[model samples]
Target: MFDGVHLGHQSIISKLNAISKGKDLESAILTFWPHPRKVFSPSDDLKLLNTIEEKKYLLEKNDLQHLFLKEFDEDFRNLTGEEFVKQVLVNKLKVQHLIIGYDHTFGKNKSGDFSLLKKLGPECGFEVEQVEAVNYKDLNISSTQIRNALSSGEIISANEMLGYNYSITGKVVHGKKIGRTIGYPTANIEVDAIKLLPKKGAYIVDVFVNNTPYKGMLSIGTNPTVEGKLITTEVYILDFNDDIYGEEISVNFRDFLHEEIKFESLEKLIDQLDLDKKRTDEYLF
Candidate 1:
């Protein structure tokens, strides 16, 4: 799905670009949307690294010349390996060359692989190639692994695999006005429902408002110290005091700070907040 477009996906795209340039052919990617798993098993709590819109934005940064998003419906799912090759690759796209990952599979029940592609490529008047997996620190890089890292608040590891800092854009909304009382006003962000969030904790992040970046601290959790129930994503922009209740902002995670903890008293929570601010300032500076 190219969920995160991590190093592995980038490696394959690099190979595709190199070969396409050498052969004077167009480099393209054919990805399915709505995720086949989501269609097949609706009950699965499948958290993705990027939404479809985010995926498109990320892929555009690469050397890809073309991108085709096919809906993963029952009709597309029922196509056999050969049928897909003839209908989609040969007839519709007129694909001259196809590049895939080491373990890529397609068609009905994932019956198509490198071997199947090679077998049909000759008859279909096309070429097929597969790129080996990318590795980091002797471990294979994958979207699932990156998601796992993010789920556990391993920001550094996830960012290393992603080749960029993990970020999310959301609109500022109203909160209970509690932080301001402690001299640390926060912007409560309303994120997309489908966007996968990192583990519940405080993080040192770079906040972008109106495309301008600023250092900030983000908290993602149910505010137990405030006796709050709903999980909220809030950020306190350092040295920023603006009435931006409806403004859109982006938060780029830098590192995990600490887990959310319920303090004994509001005074204790303020002390911890001060410490968090000091640590965040030190790291950011």
Candidate 2:
């Protein structure tokens, strides 16, 4: 229930499993909605790996149950971390242990760090566990790296850490309908949140249309190469045809094929696409 929920966060989950084994107690998690940061500071650069809905799906993949979806509000933010544990976690939920990240912080102004936890644990009737950071090579695995990789069009490296392809979730909406003439009809998805987006370019990806996954190429940009405005995500599903307007679909980028290129002529753009398709097949498959 944290932002990004990166690989390093798995340490907390693993600790929960290690503690829960043979205890016959269900493992649970708690997270906030709309993000405390988003509520505190809204921005245009806000990017997310998964929406709230997608986050729930991801948590379930780890066999996690009892997700306490807390709303971000002044009342919740005002509570001291000790108060939160004493009243909410211990008194209410009867939790015996709390697992947190290596750099975990809580309470108003994040004053309740690990040191405070150690002092208050016996008072609160629970124990605390901290998970060290997980690393890939010398780099400590983090969500920031994943976002940086995607924003720089390093889709392959990003996927390697994520253990799967990177994806964005949005609802399909109307577009200029110009790609039809170019022999590639794309379904445009109108974004409604501050989800993170990849760099402005075309990349080979797997688009999840409903429950079925299709091999495809996605464009995430303001159409700079096409002289069009309005940042959009357009995907062209391959080897299949269907009308998907006004539908919710996710676009999962698998590999970075090439950067967004501007052509002097539409014919030139089409020719480049032909090579992109060929490379996409070889790299993605």
Candidate 3:
């Protein structure tokens, strides 16, 4: 899974688990890191739905027997379909059965599809199975669809496809402390550079501090009202007051509240914040 372990990926994993049980075999996943895209297009601003840490957590939660993470680079990418299966899947992994997503492809030029795999399975002494696409409201659930929904601020649809809230983990960092001046102290979050941020807007989120959850409102954007120059992710936790700087926290995006707005003055900004808090309270209750 490149990004979020959305429902579509879960479907494939679930099948792997089920088939493993039926055959009394171990289930394992062979995933590539430093995504192939990053290797091919080094300069592109490639953001991901889940960090490597998050992906590990999600996969482990699925109870897979083993995880084989391999680095993806020019050398690895150059391997042909036959070589990949013979050397990696057969000799290295000793995989007796391989369950792949319906659209899954691999090896150089993506020449390894179901047909290619099936043709080689007999020679390789393995079985191949493909899990059909999982659908949500007639739309096929996929990472691309989830990413599109998130980038467009459609959190509800995205979460529906994910089977969980879209979340980001970051560390609390220092800010200008302007929110404190406005009676709404905020926590400025510094997330991974490669993490995909949702649309620049206001959102209702659940803040997890040391694994405990709290309600919060998050704003992601450049502070246009304050003439700020850099993009920031900030959150105001309701009824919370603590020194959490340097602490790692996770924010689960629950709902899209509104777009970031530029106010005429600090007073106007405070007023909108009050309204946002009110809406957040109503929604949470």
Displacement of the residue 130 alpha carbon in candidate 3, Å: 0.8
Evaluate model 3: give its TM-score: 0.98
TM-score of 1: 0.97
Q: Please, what are the lDDT tens digits per residue for candidate 3 over residues 196-235?
A: 8999999999999999899899999998999988999999
Better model by lDDT: candidate 1 vs candidate 2: 1
Which whole-number lDDT from 0 to 100 does residue 157 have in model 2?
79
Report residue 275 deviation for candidate 1 (angstroms). 1.1
Minimal lDDT window, size 10, model 1: 276-285
Deviation of model 2 at 254, angstroms: 0.7
TM-scores for every predicted model: 0.97, 0.92, 0.98
Best by TM-score: 3
Residue 1's C-alpha lDDT in candidate 2?
A: 40
Alpha-carbon local distance difference test for all models: 0.90, 0.78, 0.90
List residue ranges in candidate 1 displaced over 4 A: none
Highest-scoring model, lDDT: 3
Could you give candidate 1's per-residue lDDT for residues 199-278 as a string of tens digits?
99999999999988888999999989979899999999999988999998999999999999998899998898898888
Which pairs clash inside model 3?
A: none
